[model samples]
Target: MRLVVAITGASGAIYGVRILQMLSALGVESHLVTSRHAMLTLTTETDWTPEGLRSLATHVHPVGDVGSVIASGSFQHDGMIIAPCSVKTLSGVANCYADNLVTRAADVTLKEGRRLVLVFRETPLHLGHLRLLTQAAEMGATVFPPVPAFYHEPKVIDDLVDQTAGRVLDQFGLDAAVARWEGMRPLRERQDQQPDHQAALGEPVNG
Candidate 1:
């Protein structure tokens, strides 16, 4: 499956990186595009240089190069994911403003009735942010936020990122083994393995 992955200027650059890593491991063809501001985030948030990030994908498209293959609807792909999608990029997609390759590809994805998942990374949203998100959802885009799942009992930050990435991939029907939530346990089952169960499930055992 070919997947277009876009990393915007969001706070959590790791989401995009983890998505690329999982895609590569799953043998999926990843076409990556990083915004100019995304590059800045990479330097500030991660050790990855632009080239290092590019190396993770099967194809890398420049943000300004709107003539790229993914920019057109004819370019067949399974889906597109804008990991760590910034509010600016989210607005562009919400409004169908294809001023750059990222938004153009996203617009094409929506027009073609393909899955377009936007993993928006923002906090303390105002009314404008909520409206834009609703607009994007109304246009058949999945507005996914990279919220951490505490139920997964993550031991490290990578675990949280992986769980979020895995869940996001679930929207595309791709299983990355990142779902950390186990089902609710029966009374006997819970009591039989209370300590181990709590540790494994990231839940607190009461008495």
Candidate 2:
């Protein structure tokens, strides 16, 4: 499978790294791009060197390359992901602002009726943010906020990261990580186990 992965100037650059690792593991080829701000964020938030980013994708295009193949709807890809997608990139995609290849790729993904998953990372959204997200949703872009799941009983940061990446991959019909959403014992098992778990945290267990 082929996918386009864009990293923007969001706080969590680690998600981008993890997504690349997961995609590589699944043998999915990635066309990767990162904004100037995203590159800067990597320096500040991660130890990702230039070589590390290059190693993640089959082809790495500059963010300014609007004429790149992935930017056109004619280029067929299984899906696209903007891991740790910033609000700026989200707004650019939502408003049809295809000034750069990343946004253009996003626009193309929506127009082509392919999966476009945006891992929007901004928090405490105002109406403007909500509006842009709604617009993107209306255009068939999947607006996935990077929220953790308690149901998974996550014990580490990697667990949460993998679960979210797995969900994103599922949008493309690709299983990149553990199937966190399937193969449950039953709803009764969850309900039966929740009381003890919640009680340990001194919280009310509502089944």
Candidate 3:
């Protein structure tokens, strides 16, 4: 499957990086576009270089290249994802502002009636943020915030990143090795066994 991926100026640059990594592993064709601020954020937040991040995708387009193939609606692809989508980018998409390649591609995606996923990374949003998000959703965009799930028992930062990336791929019907929740039965059983094991070890158990 072919997809257009955009990395914007958001704090969690790793989300976009991991999405590219997973897409590459799945042998998916990815067209990547990274904003200038996104590159800086990547450098500040992670060790990945701009060159390394671009290498993961099948094609890389400049953020200002509005004439790129993915910017047009005729350039058919499965979908588009703006990982770590900044509020600025979100506003552009919501307002149908095609000033750049990222927003242009997103507009084309919506116009083509294809999936448009926006991984909005901001938190503690105000009313304006919510309104913009609601507007985008009303325009057939999926506003997916990278909220980490603890039920999967993430052991490290990478685990959390991978889980969120995998879930994002899931939106496209692509499955990754993310842990799925079966039910509460297993967790309850494990919790019950935990106390016994602690008692056997003569460890102090909290009531």
Best by lDDT: 3
Extract clashing residue pairs from model 1: none
How well is each residue in 1-207 modelled by candidate 1, as lDDT tens digits?
999999999999989999999999889999999998998998899899888999999999999999999999999999999999999999999999999999999999999999999999999999999999999999999989987888655789888989999898898788897756678768896567545866678776664
Over 93-150, each residue of candidate 2 has an lDDT whose tens digit, in order, gives 9999988988999999998898899999998999999999999999999999989875
lDDT of 3: 0.93
Error of 1 at 173 (Å): 1.3
What is the C-alpha lDDT profile of model 3 across 1-207, one tens digit per residue?
999999999999999999999998999999999987999999999999999999999999999888899988889899999999999999999999989999999999999999999999898999999999999999999989999988777789999999999999999999878877766667677786454766788887664
**Better model by TM-score: candidate 2 vs candidate 3:** 3
For each candidate, what is the lDDT?
0.92, 0.87, 0.93
RMSD in angstroms between candidate 3 and the native structure over all alpha carbons: 2.6
Off by over 4 Å in 1: 186-207
Ranking 1 against 2 by TM-score, winner:
1
Error of 3 at 30 (Å): 0.3
What are the per-model C-alpha RMSD values against the true structure? 4.1, 3.7, 2.6
Q: Ten consecutive residues with minimal summed lDDT in candidate 2?
A: 176-185
Count of backbone collisions in candidate 3: 0
